[model samples]
Target: KHRWAMYIDVSKCYGCYACVAACAAENNVPIGVFRTWIERHVTKGGTVIFVPKQCNHCENAPCVKACPTGATYKRTEDGLVLVNDDLCIGCGACIQACPYGARFFNPVKGVVDKCTFCEHRIYQGKLPACVETCPTGARVFGDLNDPESPVSQLVKKMPTSRLKEWTGAEPMIFYRDLPSEADL
Candidate 1:
Protein backbone atom coordinates (compact mmCIF):
# COMPACT_ATOMS: atom_id res chain seq x y z
CA LYS A 1 0.00 0.00 0.00
CA HIS A 2 3.00 2.26 -0.26
CA ARG A 3 3.20 4.77 -3.10
CA TRP A 4 6.87 5.68 -3.23
CA ALA A 5 7.86 9.09 -4.57
CA MET A 6 10.75 11.52 -4.82
CA TYR A 7 10.85 15.27 -4.20
CA ILE A 8 13.68 17.27 -5.71
CA ASP A 9 14.57 20.67 -4.32
CA VAL A 10 15.82 22.21 -7.50
CA SER A 11 17.28 25.19 -5.72
CA LYS A 12 19.41 22.97 -3.52
CA CYS A 13 21.08 21.11 -6.34
CA TYR A 14 24.58 22.49 -6.92
CA GLY A 15 25.41 20.54 -10.08
CA CYS A 16 27.94 18.39 -8.21
CA TYR A 17 26.94 15.27 -10.18
CA ALA A 18 27.49 13.14 -7.07
CA CYS A 19 24.04 11.67 -7.53
CA VAL A 20 24.85 10.86 -11.13
CA ALA A 21 28.06 9.08 -10.21
CA ALA A 22 26.38 7.15 -7.42
CA CYS A 23 23.57 6.04 -9.69
CA ALA A 24 26.01 4.76 -12.29
CA ALA A 25 28.04 2.81 -9.73
CA GLU A 26 25.10 1.46 -7.82
CA ASN A 27 23.10 0.45 -10.91
CA ASN A 28 25.98 -0.67 -13.14
CA VAL A 29 24.88 1.69 -15.84
CA PRO A 30 27.07 1.49 -18.89
CA ILE A 31 29.30 4.26 -20.16
CA GLY A 32 27.66 6.86 -22.45
CA VAL A 33 24.24 6.14 -20.88
CA PHE A 34 22.61 7.00 -17.64
CA ARG A 35 19.67 5.93 -15.55
CA THR A 36 19.74 9.35 -13.95
CA TRP A 37 21.35 12.58 -15.11
CA ILE A 38 21.44 16.25 -14.35
CA GLU A 39 20.46 19.16 -16.55
CA ARG A 40 21.89 22.61 -15.96
CA HIS A 41 19.57 25.42 -16.92
CA VAL A 42 20.24 29.12 -16.89
CA THR A 43 17.39 31.57 -16.72
CA LYS A 44 17.19 34.64 -18.96
CA GLY A 45 18.14 36.66 -15.86
CA GLY A 46 21.35 34.59 -15.55
CA THR A 47 20.44 32.35 -12.64
CA VAL A 48 21.52 28.72 -12.93
CA ILE A 49 19.76 25.66 -11.61
CA PHE A 50 20.51 21.98 -11.91
CA VAL A 51 17.56 19.70 -12.49
CA PRO A 52 18.04 16.03 -11.90
CA LYS A 53 16.36 13.92 -14.55
CA GLN A 54 15.26 10.31 -14.51
CA CYS A 55 12.30 8.03 -14.99
CA ASN A 56 9.20 9.62 -13.62
CA HIS A 57 7.73 6.18 -12.84
CA CYS A 58 4.45 7.50 -14.09
CA GLU A 59 1.15 6.11 -12.88
CA ASN A 60 0.00 6.02 -16.48
CA ALA A 61 3.35 5.22 -18.06
CA PRO A 62 3.36 5.21 -21.85
CA CYS A 63 6.40 2.91 -21.75
CA VAL A 64 4.37 0.20 -20.08
CA LYS A 65 1.63 0.41 -22.68
CA ALA A 66 4.08 0.50 -25.57
CA CYS A 67 5.94 -2.66 -24.65
CA PRO A 68 5.17 -5.47 -27.09
CA THR A 69 6.15 -7.94 -24.40
CA GLY A 70 5.46 -7.62 -20.70
CA ALA A 71 8.94 -6.35 -20.02
CA THR A 72 7.89 -3.02 -18.68
CA TYR A 73 5.54 -2.81 -15.73
CA LYS A 74 4.57 -0.69 -12.79
CA ARG A 75 4.58 -2.28 -9.37
CA THR A 76 1.29 -1.73 -7.67
CA GLU A 77 2.81 -2.01 -4.20
CA ASP A 78 5.27 0.85 -4.48
CA GLY A 79 4.48 2.52 -7.83
CA LEU A 80 7.91 1.64 -9.21
CA VAL A 81 8.09 1.27 -12.97
CA LEU A 82 10.50 -1.54 -13.84
CA VAL A 83 11.83 -3.65 -16.64
CA ASN A 84 12.11 -7.40 -16.64
CA ASP A 85 15.23 -8.35 -18.51
CA ASP A 86 13.91 -11.82 -19.25
CA LEU A 87 10.88 -10.42 -21.00
CA CYS A 88 12.64 -7.52 -22.69
CA ILE A 89 13.24 -7.73 -26.43
CA GLY A 90 15.03 -4.38 -26.73
CA CYS A 91 12.58 -3.39 -29.43
CA GLY A 92 12.91 0.27 -28.36
CA ALA A 93 9.15 0.71 -28.34
CA CYS A 94 9.20 1.78 -24.72
CA ILE A 95 12.07 4.15 -25.40
CA GLN A 96 10.10 5.92 -28.11
CA ALA A 97 7.00 6.04 -25.95
CA CYS A 98 8.68 7.73 -23.01
CA PRO A 99 8.29 11.48 -23.37
CA TYR A 100 10.90 12.04 -20.65
CA GLY A 101 13.59 10.17 -22.56
CA ALA A 102 14.33 7.97 -19.56
CA ARG A 103 14.82 4.62 -21.19
CA PHE A 104 17.76 3.27 -23.14
CA PHE A 105 18.91 0.01 -24.71
CA ASN A 106 21.69 -1.59 -22.67
CA PRO A 107 24.38 -3.11 -24.84
CA VAL A 108 25.76 -5.14 -21.96
CA LYS A 109 22.40 -6.59 -20.99
CA GLY A 110 20.87 -6.44 -24.44
CA VAL A 111 17.67 -5.13 -22.88
CA VAL A 112 15.97 -1.88 -22.12
CA ASP A 113 17.00 -0.33 -18.81
CA LYS A 114 16.04 2.63 -16.69
CA CYS A 115 15.88 3.97 -13.19
CA THR A 116 13.92 1.96 -10.64
CA PHE A 117 14.45 4.39 -7.82
CA CYS A 118 17.03 1.90 -6.67
CA GLU A 119 14.36 -0.59 -5.72
CA HIS A 120 16.91 -3.15 -4.63
CA ARG A 121 18.30 -0.75 -2.06
CA ILE A 122 14.94 0.68 -1.04
CA TYR A 123 13.48 -2.73 -0.20
CA GLN A 124 16.49 -3.19 2.07
CA GLY A 125 15.45 -0.16 4.07
CA LYS A 126 18.08 2.04 2.44
CA LEU A 127 17.76 5.22 0.45
CA PRO A 128 18.27 5.28 -3.28
CA ALA A 129 21.91 5.84 -4.13
CA CYS A 130 21.20 9.20 -5.68
CA VAL A 131 19.32 10.35 -2.62
CA GLU A 132 21.96 9.01 -0.26
CA THR A 133 24.85 10.44 -2.21
CA CYS A 134 23.42 13.88 -2.83
CA PRO A 135 25.72 16.31 -1.04
CA THR A 136 23.15 19.07 -0.92
CA GLY A 137 20.26 16.85 0.14
CA ALA A 138 18.36 17.91 -2.93
CA ARG A 139 16.54 14.62 -3.30
CA VAL A 140 14.01 13.25 -0.83
CA PHE A 141 12.30 9.91 -1.18
CA GLY A 142 9.62 8.12 0.81
CA ASP A 143 6.19 6.57 0.73
CA LEU A 144 3.78 9.23 -0.41
CA ASN A 145 0.91 7.34 1.19
CA ASP A 146 2.45 7.99 4.61
CA PRO A 147 1.28 11.33 5.86
CA GLU A 148 4.38 11.74 7.99
CA SER A 149 6.87 10.86 5.29
CA PRO A 150 9.24 13.58 4.11
CA VAL A 151 8.14 13.28 0.52
CA SER A 152 4.49 13.64 1.42
CA GLN A 153 5.14 16.52 3.77
CA LEU A 154 7.21 18.37 1.17
CA VAL A 155 4.60 17.87 -1.51
CA LYS A 156 1.92 19.20 0.84
CA LYS A 157 3.89 22.24 2.00
CA MET A 158 5.61 23.34 -1.21
CA PRO A 159 4.67 24.37 -4.68
CA THR A 160 5.85 21.57 -6.91
CA SER A 161 5.75 20.70 -10.59
CA ARG A 162 5.97 17.56 -12.67
CA LEU A 163 7.39 17.51 -16.16
CA LYS A 164 5.28 17.07 -19.27
CA GLU A 165 2.00 17.15 -17.39
CA TRP A 166 0.22 17.67 -20.70
CA THR A 167 1.13 14.12 -21.73
CA GLY A 168 -0.89 12.87 -18.78
CA ALA A 169 1.75 10.41 -17.67
CA GLU A 170 1.09 11.49 -14.10
CA PRO A 171 4.80 11.43 -13.29
CA MET A 172 5.58 10.84 -9.64
CA ILE A 173 8.79 12.85 -9.52
CA PHE A 174 8.02 16.25 -8.05
CA TYR A 175 10.17 19.34 -8.30
CA ARG A 176 10.29 21.84 -5.48
CA ASP A 177 11.53 25.40 -5.95
CA LEU A 178 11.62 24.98 -9.70
CA PRO A 179 12.12 28.35 -11.30
CA SER A 180 9.50 29.24 -13.87
CA GLU A 181 12.11 30.54 -16.28
CA ALA A 182 14.13 27.33 -16.35
CA ASP A 183 13.27 25.43 -19.49
CA LEU A 184 12.24 21.89 -18.58
Candidate 2:
Protein backbone atom coordinates (compact mmCIF):
# COMPACT_ATOMS: atom_id res chain seq x y z
CA LYS A 1 0.00 0.00 0.00
CA HIS A 2 1.41 3.33 -1.02
CA ARG A 3 0.48 6.25 1.19
CA TRP A 4 1.18 9.19 -1.04
CA ALA A 5 2.05 12.74 0.03
CA MET A 6 3.24 16.00 -1.44
CA TYR A 7 5.94 18.38 -0.24
CA ILE A 8 5.89 22.01 -1.28
CA ASP A 9 8.83 24.23 -0.49
CA VAL A 10 7.31 27.68 -0.33
CA SER A 11 10.67 29.31 -0.75
CA LYS A 12 11.16 27.66 -4.12
CA CYS A 13 7.89 28.75 -5.68
CA TYR A 14 8.39 31.63 -8.12
CA GLY A 15 4.69 32.26 -8.82
CA CYS A 16 5.17 31.52 -12.50
CA TYR A 17 1.72 29.85 -12.59
CA ALA A 18 3.31 27.11 -14.66
CA CYS A 19 2.00 24.44 -12.32
CA VAL A 20 -1.46 26.02 -12.49
CA ALA A 21 -1.46 26.06 -16.28
CA ALA A 22 -0.09 22.55 -16.52
CA CYS A 23 -2.65 21.12 -14.11
CA ALA A 24 -5.57 22.76 -15.93
CA ALA A 25 -4.41 21.42 -19.28
CA GLU A 26 -3.65 17.92 -18.03
CA ASN A 27 -6.91 17.54 -16.13
CA ASN A 28 -9.04 19.17 -18.85
CA VAL A 29 -10.47 21.53 -16.27
CA PRO A 30 -13.26 23.70 -17.59
CA ILE A 31 -12.87 27.44 -17.88
CA GLY A 32 -13.38 29.37 -14.59
CA VAL A 33 -12.65 26.18 -12.63
CA PHE A 34 -9.22 25.09 -11.52
CA ARG A 35 -7.82 21.87 -10.15
CA THR A 36 -4.84 23.79 -8.87
CA TRP A 37 -4.12 27.47 -8.41
CA ILE A 38 -1.45 29.79 -7.02
CA GLU A 39 -2.21 32.34 -4.31
CA ARG A 40 -0.18 35.49 -4.03
CA HIS A 41 0.27 37.21 -0.67
CA VAL A 42 1.80 40.66 -0.68
CA THR A 43 2.92 42.06 2.63
CA LYS A 44 2.81 45.74 3.46
CA GLY A 45 6.60 45.72 3.20
CA GLY A 46 6.33 44.94 -0.52
CA THR A 47 7.35 41.32 -0.04
CA VAL A 48 5.37 38.87 -2.12
CA ILE A 49 4.80 35.20 -1.31
CA PHE A 50 3.32 32.56 -3.58
CA VAL A 51 1.42 29.63 -2.22
CA PRO A 52 0.06 26.87 -4.38
CA LYS A 53 -3.39 25.68 -3.41
CA GLN A 54 -5.12 22.42 -4.28
CA CYS A 55 -7.12 19.66 -2.72
CA ASN A 56 -5.36 18.59 0.44
CA HIS A 57 -6.57 15.02 -0.08
CA CYS A 58 -7.32 15.04 3.60
CA GLU A 59 -7.27 11.90 5.70
CA ASN A 60 -10.50 12.85 7.41
CA ALA A 61 -12.00 14.65 4.46
CA PRO A 62 -15.04 16.79 5.14
CA CYS A 63 -16.11 16.52 1.51
CA VAL A 64 -16.56 12.79 1.93
CA LYS A 65 -18.74 13.44 4.91
CA ALA A 66 -20.80 16.15 3.19
CA CYS A 67 -21.71 14.15 0.11
CA PRO A 68 -25.30 12.95 0.17
CA THR A 69 -24.13 9.99 -1.87
CA GLY A 70 -20.81 8.22 -1.67
CA ALA A 71 -19.46 10.18 -4.58
CA THR A 72 -16.60 11.67 -2.63
CA TYR A 73 -14.29 9.11 -1.10
CA LYS A 74 -10.69 8.43 -0.35
CA ARG A 75 -8.74 5.62 -1.91
CA THR A 76 -7.40 3.36 0.81
CA GLU A 77 -4.52 2.16 -1.32
CA ASP A 78 -2.91 5.55 -1.89
CA GLY A 79 -4.73 7.85 0.51
CA LEU A 80 -5.98 9.97 -2.39
CA VAL A 81 -9.34 11.70 -2.16
CA LEU A 82 -11.35 11.07 -5.34
CA VAL A 83 -14.78 11.62 -6.75
CA ASN A 84 -17.11 9.15 -8.40
CA ASP A 85 -18.72 11.29 -11.06
CA ASP A 86 -21.46 8.77 -11.75
CA LEU A 87 -22.56 8.90 -8.15
CA CYS A 88 -22.36 12.66 -7.88
CA ILE A 89 -25.65 14.49 -7.51
CA GLY A 90 -24.24 17.92 -8.43
CA CYS A 91 -24.89 19.07 -4.88
CA GLY A 92 -22.59 21.80 -3.58
CA ALA A 93 -22.09 20.17 -0.18
CA CYS A 94 -18.65 18.88 -0.98
CA ILE A 95 -17.57 22.23 -2.30
CA GLN A 96 -18.79 24.00 0.79
CA ALA A 97 -17.37 21.42 3.18
CA CYS A 98 -13.88 21.88 1.86
CA PRO A 99 -12.06 24.35 4.08
CA TYR A 100 -9.32 24.92 1.53
CA GLY A 101 -11.85 25.99 -1.11
CA ALA A 102 -10.41 23.38 -3.41
CA ARG A 103 -13.60 21.77 -4.67
CA PHE A 104 -15.77 23.18 -7.43
CA PHE A 105 -18.93 22.21 -9.25
CA ASN A 106 -17.94 21.73 -12.87
CA PRO A 107 -20.78 23.05 -15.00
CA VAL A 108 -19.47 21.15 -18.00
CA LYS A 109 -19.56 17.83 -16.18
CA GLY A 110 -22.37 18.58 -13.78
CA VAL A 111 -20.33 17.11 -10.97
CA VAL A 112 -18.01 18.28 -8.24
CA ASP A 113 -14.36 18.24 -9.27
CA LYS A 114 -11.02 18.64 -7.55
CA CYS A 115 -7.41 17.60 -7.70
CA THR A 116 -6.60 13.89 -7.57
CA PHE A 117 -2.86 14.30 -7.37
CA CYS A 118 -2.97 13.31 -11.03
CA GLU A 119 -3.49 9.65 -10.13
CA HIS A 120 -3.97 8.93 -13.85
CA ARG A 121 -0.29 9.67 -14.30
CA ILE A 122 0.85 8.34 -10.93
CA TYR A 123 -0.48 4.87 -11.62
CA GLN A 124 1.41 4.90 -14.91
CA GLY A 125 4.70 5.57 -13.09
CA LYS A 126 4.75 9.22 -14.16
CA LEU A 127 4.74 12.35 -12.06
CA PRO A 128 1.76 14.70 -11.99
CA ALA A 129 1.81 17.35 -14.71
CA CYS A 130 2.11 20.17 -12.22
CA VAL A 131 5.04 18.50 -10.49
CA GLU A 132 6.68 17.73 -13.81
CA THR A 133 6.27 21.22 -15.21
CA CYS A 134 7.24 23.26 -12.17
CA PRO A 135 10.39 25.16 -13.20
CA THR A 136 11.64 25.67 -9.65
CA GLY A 137 10.92 22.14 -8.42
CA ALA A 138 8.84 23.54 -5.59
CA ARG A 139 6.43 20.65 -5.56
CA VAL A 140 7.38 17.04 -4.89
CA PHE A 141 5.20 13.95 -4.83
CA GLY A 142 5.96 10.49 -3.47
CA ASP A 143 4.76 7.56 -1.44
CA LEU A 144 5.10 8.42 2.21
CA ASN A 145 5.16 4.73 2.95
CA ASP A 146 8.60 4.63 1.45
CA PRO A 147 11.03 6.27 3.79
CA GLU A 148 13.50 6.63 0.97
CA SER A 149 11.15 8.82 -1.04
CA PRO A 150 12.17 12.43 -1.50
CA VAL A 151 9.03 13.77 0.12
CA SER A 152 9.56 11.59 3.17
CA GLN A 153 13.21 12.53 3.48
CA LEU A 154 12.53 16.22 3.08
CA VAL A 155 9.70 16.13 5.58
CA LYS A 156 11.98 14.60 8.19
CA LYS A 157 14.43 17.47 7.82
CA MET A 158 12.13 20.39 7.11
CA PRO A 159 9.76 22.31 9.28
CA THR A 160 6.51 21.41 7.55
CA SER A 161 2.97 22.57 8.16
CA ARG A 162 -0.39 21.83 6.61
CA LEU A 163 -2.92 24.40 5.52
CA LYS A 164 -5.62 25.07 8.11
CA GLU A 165 -4.08 22.52 10.45
CA TRP A 166 -6.58 23.43 13.14
CA THR A 167 -9.40 22.01 11.03
CA GLY A 168 -8.19 18.46 11.77
CA ALA A 169 -8.68 17.35 8.19
CA GLU A 170 -5.11 16.06 8.27
CA PRO A 171 -4.15 17.41 4.87
CA MET A 172 -1.52 15.45 3.04
CA ILE A 173 0.02 18.49 1.42
CA PHE A 174 2.99 19.61 3.50
CA TYR A 175 4.63 23.00 3.23
CA ARG A 176 8.08 24.21 4.14
CA ASP A 177 8.97 27.86 4.70
CA LEU A 178 5.38 28.95 4.21
CA PRO A 179 4.58 32.55 4.96
CA SER A 180 2.46 33.39 8.02
CA GLU A 181 -0.25 35.04 5.92
CA ALA A 182 -0.88 32.09 3.62
CA ASP A 183 -3.54 29.85 5.16
CA LEU A 184 -4.39 27.58 2.29
Task: Assess candidate 2 and give its lDDT.
Answer: 0.92
Q: Which ten residues in a row have the lowest lDDT in candidate 2?
A: 40-49
Model 1: residues with Cα > 4 Å off, grouped in runs: 181-183
The true-versus-predicted C-alpha distance at residue 138 of model 2, in Å, is 0.4
Tell me the alpha-carbon RMSD of every candidate: 1.0, 1.1
Candidate 1 local lDDT, 89-180, one digit each (tens): 88999999999999999999999999999999988999999999998899999999999999999999999999888899999999987776
- The pairs that clash in candidate 1 are none
Residues 110-144 of candidate 2 have per-residue lDDT tens digits of 88899999999999999999999999999999989
Computed on alpha carbons, the lDDT of every model, listed in order, comes to: 0.92, 0.92
Who wins the lDDT comparison?
1
